[model samples]
Target chain A: MTGTGGRARYLWLGGLVAICLGLLALAAWQLVVLERQMRIAATENMIWVFGQTQIEALNLALALSDEAALQQIQTRFDILVSRLTLLEDGPQRRFLENAGVSETLARWRSGLLALDPAQGADPAALRAHVTALVAALRTKASLVMSHEWQSQATRLDSLRHLHLLALMSVLGAAVAGLGLVAILIDRERRLMSGQLDHLRAEKLASDLERERETSENHRRFADLIAHQFRTPLAVIDSAMHRLTRRSGGPVPPELISEKAAVSREAVARLVKLTDTALMMSRLERDAVLPSLRAHDLNDLVSSVIDDLMATAWDRDPARIRQSVQTEPTVALCDPMLTAEILSNLLRNALLYSPPDCRVDVSVFQSRDCIVCRIEDRGRGMSPEEIECAFDRFYRGSGHETLPGSGLGLTLARDLARIQGGDVTLSQRDGGGLTAALYLPKDDVA
Target chain B: MSLRYHIVQTALMTALVFMAVPAAAEDVLLTLTGAVTDGRVEMTRADFDTMDWHEFSTSTSVTDGRPEFRGVLMRDALAHAGAEGSSVRATALNDYVVDIPVEDFHRFDVLAALYMDDVPLTPRDKGPVWIVYPRDNHGVLADIRYDMRWVWQLVALHVQ
Candidate 1:
């Protein structure tokens, strides 16, 4: 319904309907005309009676010539009179009057009535009277016949015209019907082509959008690699420089050891940054495949905490308070991915908070989901930071001083989602940050 | 002697009144000649009067005004003559002839009319007997075929 095709379809359909209605009207009119034509009061009915009168008159004259009996002649005369009476009365009389034969016809009727066969009138006189009257009736019959012919011809002519008009209407309707079909076909083709063009445009737009997003991801990755590698490289270079400067003097063992530890820590930071960057790209490309299953949340959380503490030089049990609010703390997730996500959140809590301040870790059911809540005694993120905290390489301004790859929260959320779970950061109940990892609970337990 | 003559005249008039109209009913107004197993059957006006009568009102094409007709069903007349045929050719007194299918007698309540509005028809009129169809009662009887079957001044029915 878009263009000239739509308008043309309407025009064709409307014209077809109009033609059909016209055909119906013509059919009704034809029925009326045919009914009129089928009438008994036709010119032919009067013409037949007129011709019969002439025949009867001739028979009467013939009977007189043949010397027929009085009773026989009277019967013939009676039949003739009956034919004249048919002309004298009813709708036929009106027609005869119009044909200009009324005066002569009335005279003929009176003359025929004058004859009386039963009385035995003179033969010669009866012959003369019958002959003269027959001649007059002949003239009137001619007049009636001529008028009947003219009327019949006129009727046939009008009927022919009516037939021609009906035929023309039917022909016009057929042409319009064909035209309507052709227009419908053309409209269907145009609509199909239009739909194909629309689909092609949609595909083109989506391809362009995907390409822009991919190029943007590549650009961000390049900046992240440059910035993150440079800081760690500079620290490692500084450590190497300090060792080389002591190389020419009495190199104290403590100084060498301190420099070695500094160089190793920077190398470890670079390694972590490389791993985080690799994880970010893999997750973006949908390449991270996790084997998901039901797991005990308590086991996952405790293992992550144990592994994190084993890697810490000043690890203390008092630094983190653990609580399990449900007996069977089962969550449906990939065990390895869940451990990685929990390790990231707990490590962030310990690293960001003051050393003496204790962190709280709790496992409980929040409705149908199992939540591992990590609360830290550290300043929480602003709403803006929380909004984009899961965007790859998105770190808050003050977080630049902390030892982090800025991909921890993003990878943790991405991995958790892959296992049908999610991680969110919010302001804590007190004066810290809360990181909650939610997973679908295993109903079997 | 004059009182005896008056009594005799009175007796004659009373006898005529007690019987049906036998004055003009003696004439053989209609004759059925063909396909009658019992040979030609001649129907006088009194013969039509004695038969069971059917009545109907109808408008005619030739005549103006609707007229009520009193007559016997043509089927009853055909049955009385022991007539058996598919059709009958009715010959008018003026030699006008038209063939009518016998089925028409049973299909419509067709009448061989002896009277129109209580007046007996004569040859000077369109009947001594005229064939009339119940055109007003049946719409299909208004058709031209049935109209042609409304044979007037009908003198003879030759069943063929």
Candidate 2:
């Protein structure tokens, strides 16, 4: 969602790569050390030098008379001595010491001392010395061989251990890298799904709002037609009544009979207005598209009352009372539409009543529907006003100054009927209005 | 003048007899000179056999394997010669010379070997008196310097 989170993910991945690279570098360093050790093993050991010394001594004994041969033999001995010097000290001596062969090496040196070429010059003496030297060299060579074997074995073992450690570290880095990747991918997937859910929720809310607007328009058009016809029909009916009551008018009986017939037709037209209103009300009820599910009416009433207390004009929670007589009243209704209906009724009660006077709400169960009643200690509506309350845009006389769109009662009744419910406004004996909303009970089967 | 000639001839014959008689009697195998407070030690092979002997088995450059050497110790020989010196210069019959610190005689069982593996040594065998160090017994004597001191056919020690 933010650069910070993305940056943290990259940082984690970078750290994993760095760890792997560090392990690889360690492996490379070990290899370099191993190469150096191998070089020491190859160039500095005395076994082969002693072998060369043996060959040179044999040659010296065989060619004792030749000056050039003697020089070559001397040179070979010098070379052997130089190689032996490597074993006398430094890392090679330390290696021999660690291998428990230093004493043996010292003894070999002692034998070499006895076999020095300067000791005798005669061929017979030289041959005897060379013979002894060969035996000593052989013994010394074997000692060196076994010592080298042990030292090399030790070195190889440590090298293997270092390699194993490097391999395990590399593997650990790999697993950690994979784990980080998996966690990041999973988080990304969850974030994408969350975004999708948010978009879907927005689309559903908009769809519901659009459908509600279309339904409201249909109901408003029908109410407009009914209201427009009611006025003309009322005027015709009043005029007939006025004419029928007039006495001493200079008119024939037949004329009076014709006026009476005109009055009856006008009254019938007024009755048709009531029929038109009923037909429109049915149309409004039928317009309801119920996506029904089981819900609790008591919880709905409590929640709507709470909402009204907060949002309704001139409403205070302290002045409102609630009681769920049915307790856990379950109903088969669309919860959203049911909540809308209860909210409308509760809002009207809290708005119309005096600020200090209490508005009371109660939820009770009927045989087929659960009913919630919102009663307020306000000026009660007349019977005619109560009958016309369901008509869209119908504001009662002397109530035109009220802060409402006059669609509250109309929407309330329309929403109620759609959810297999109904709403009615009645006068309380104590001078208040009570609006009842009925919701169909949930079917257990 | 005839009397003088007769006298000189008798002296020459006597000198010849004396020189010839000792050569037939004994051979001098080793000569020790220089810095001996007691005087020079000229020992023949028979004289060396008469001295107290020490023995050790050791590998030598002139021989195969370890051979038991029987001889007088150099330290004892030096003492017999009443030698006073810090160092001994040993010369092989081939004239290869090496300076051997007296400490070597004290520190190691060095033998002026007359017999190797119970056999009397000859010049061809790197004897009559081979300077031998018990190399097998002492690891410190195992070096080129010490090896050079093991002079074969050792003819003289000039202790100085």
Candidate 3:
């Protein structure tokens, strides 16, 4: 795989490991806490049972001077002592030893047994002995309880330390994982940036190839046009020279006039062809950049109609009727290009229609665009002609009487596209043709 | 009723009342003397073997002497005395009295002994009758209070 993808995988794995480790540490800490709690509970229970039993024995000793009571108390005390002895030798033995509880119990027992009812002379002595015994027992019980409490505290402290260590280790692992991820991300970013630079270099090379192809196509077109016109110009020059240098001084006037007229018509035809070629070239170059500006589309349409009125009137004065069929709208475009587009449509309308046929020019705003329609009430174009209207240098076969170059609609479509607009010709449903120009509103432009 | 007839009825009633007194009311009484030197007491081997006495042993210990004891338990003694009450008041001849909790007797062995070191004890030696326990049997009975299983003398046991 690519370096960036590899690094991403590494980062994902690290994050997953970190998460698992974190959960494991949390579980371990929880277990430790639970175990510590259980230990404390057990210790507390043992201490409580031992204390209660001791108290009962003390009360029994005080109540019964019978030797049997003492014996029974001693027996019960021995069991407690054995348990305590086992505890002393176990994990918490140091705590019990430090409390000095066993010795205290031993001393209390000795004191009680040493008391003599016969030698006491007064009840006070016996009471004192009982009091001493009780006090001693209390001391032993308190010591055992305190030792247990201290052992619990120690265990708690140890548990806290263990938890803290676990937390620190987990944190350390997380930090390490984060560091790895950061490194991986940085590496991935570097790789992606390198890839982007490579792609940009490739794009620049591709752009250079396209520009080279465009220049070659232009060169080939210019060469073909220059070669085609050179022979015609040579023929015209030769004919003119021969006419000027004739040996017979007097020539036939009819032949001279006819030849001169023919020559003049040929030259004119050549000029027109040259002009069409130049116009096509200009349109092609203008595809790269158009002279865009805010202009009233209604005024543009009106001006084109006025320019074409003479031609339309020559066909049939009544057929040249025009009307603005829509509200005034402004559009962002080249005015020359707009006029050219409208003139072509109007001229076509006049050429194809019979006398008294009307043509309409109108403009309006639709949503965020300006729409201009040129409707001709004349012989409409066929579906095939309408579909191919915007193709370069295409002339319909039915337009034999019309004197026109087929580049008009093509130039208009190119201009519209450059200005972020479009032009379309559709056969009217009833009759004639409708050419619609859609231009972006000035604000949208 | 005549005075002689009244005297006769009172004599008869008196004689009948005397007949109702228990034989134990006429038994010989023994008094205890001197301090109990041994931290614990137990039955003499002789008394333990000969008498058909109530007996029991407990693993628990008294705080007066040593950690352990093996002897006739206090509950057995109280049971033999037909103790009807919840309390046992044990008094020495010198009026040294201690109230023995009845519940304690049920829990551990507390014995009255007449011997120590396998010999009959003398009064001067804090014996003739003493309460003793086998202190070496368990470590819990090592306390000095278990040692207070008084030795020198033990007298009346009153159940209340």
Candidate 4:
């Protein structure tokens, strides 16, 4: 159910960031604890405490003559003993142990322990002990203070060293985390850039493919134009040359008209070929938008059939049969474009079929459109040819040698489509091709 | 009582017990003292051979290649001297001392080697007795600390 991977990736990144923050927090906490320990160590210097105890003991001995003084002396003695006890056995002994202070403290502790406060309550005895203790304390206190200062300095150095170590470790962790993050970002950037590059490459490839197709189409058009124009031009030139030679000889009037007619026919073919090619080029570019007008479908088809029959050179006119509806069928279309469409379809029907075969033309109104169907009892196109029948340069199978530029069907289709209509070629029933043309009906219809 | 008294008594007893002892037991290679029930124990190559001899092949930093070390286990050697301690301060011929925890002998098959390549070693060759751990067999022991602990020409062990 959880198919979106991008969300998971962001969650992992957030988790990693949280872990890095937690590590930093832990390091800061440790640093705070170490700082607290350093502060406490700095304030609790035992050497100074030991010196104060000695001063208090001396004061107690001076004040031991009265009851209040006696009680004060007892308290002072207890305090001095406690200080000595700290020097002897407390955690601070490690600093004083290496110094010769341990020996002096040990001797004083033993002597002081042997002297009971109640048994040695006499002020004279207490004074003697206090005086000796003071002398011993005086000699050792400064030595102990120097030792303690040295130890504190050493401890401070070690703490600074530890602080530096912690700082370096935290910095190292930060650098490592940042380096990993940088690597991930760089990798993501590269992946994104790679995807962009792939898309760009794909677009460039398609562009190259389209350019290649355009150039190929241009090359085919050039060959077709040259071949189509040269034949007609060559026919006209030969006919004129023949006429000029004959005129220089015996100028026969009947042969002259015939020769002139042949040249005129060739010239007409050249002009028609040029016009068709120019129209095809314009239609290919979608440069001509249709100018529609109301026209009778029956008249349009009948006129087209007459023009083909008049131009029929080898075929008999009786082979084309037309069936037009007696009722007026008006359609909205470009008249000249409709004529070009009908002419191309009729010509193809006449040329593809045998001269003896019948070409049928029918025009009728079908609902909102005017439909014209042309059927020929000729060799029908295969499924493949029928599929590509309207493609620019596709002359049907077995019709390559036929007098055609292969643009007739394409031009007919383009012309029909320009007037909000369409032309389709299909294999007619009983082995022949049929072309159906449809044009939009007039608004009055 | 005194070291001289005990030495004299031992000499008299040795002289009386075996006047024609073998020369193999004559050369003492390792000495043990401190926290030992025997007070002191001197081990000759013959005395080591009398104990269990374990043969193991291992390479050492001081050696060119893997060689078969024939020796008694450190635990057996310590037992021979009646050693009772948590750690042993091993001393080399060059006076280099290092504290080896008794746990090392218990943890690994360490050796007090008397011979290298079936030949008795002298002080110059880093032995009359050498403390060797199977460094090649146990990769964990192949470290500088363990290498330093492998004292060559091991002359004394003070258990404490």
User: Mind giving the per-residue lDDT tens digits that candidate 3 earns over A1-445?
Assistant: 6889888867777776777577567757766775545432233444754564465446545544443544343333333333333243223333445666544443343343344333233344544666565666666677678777887788778778766766766677677667667776887899899999999999999999989977875675566456545655765676677677788877678657656655665465456457656767876665346688998888887777766553321344455455545465879988877776676666667666665768766688999889887777777888888888776556677763344556667777776777889988898777988888988889944
lDDT of 2 by residue, B41-83 (tens): 8888677767899998987543346889899999988887789
A317-362 per-residue lDDT for model 1 (tens digits): 6898888555778888888778878888998898888888999999
In model 3, where do residues sit more than 4 Å from their true spots? A1-24, A27-100, A103-157, A183-335, A346-385, A391-407, A414-422, A428-445, B1-160
The per-model lDDT (C-alpha) reads: 0.78, 0.68, 0.57, 0.75
Compare the candidates by lDDT and give the number of the best one.
1
Weakest 10 consecutive residues of candidate 1 chain A by summed lDDT: A110-119
Model 4 iRMS (Å) reads 24.9
Chain B of candidate 1 vs. true chain B, TM: 0.82
lDDT of 2 by residue, A240-266 (tens): 666667787666676566666555554
lDDT of 4 at A248: 62
Per-candidate interface DockQ score: 0.25, 0.02, 0.02, 0.01
Instruction: Kindly indicate the candidate among 1 and 3 with the higher lDDT.
Output: 1
State each candidate's chain A TM-score: 0.72, 0.41, 0.53, 0.58
Model 2 CAPRI quality: incorrect
**lDDT score for candidate 4 against the true structure:** 0.75
| Candidate 2 residue-wise lDDT at A284 | 55
Q: Which residue pairs in candidate 2 have backbone atoms (N, alpha carbon, C) closer than 3 angstroms, thus clashing?
A: A110-B142, A129-B61
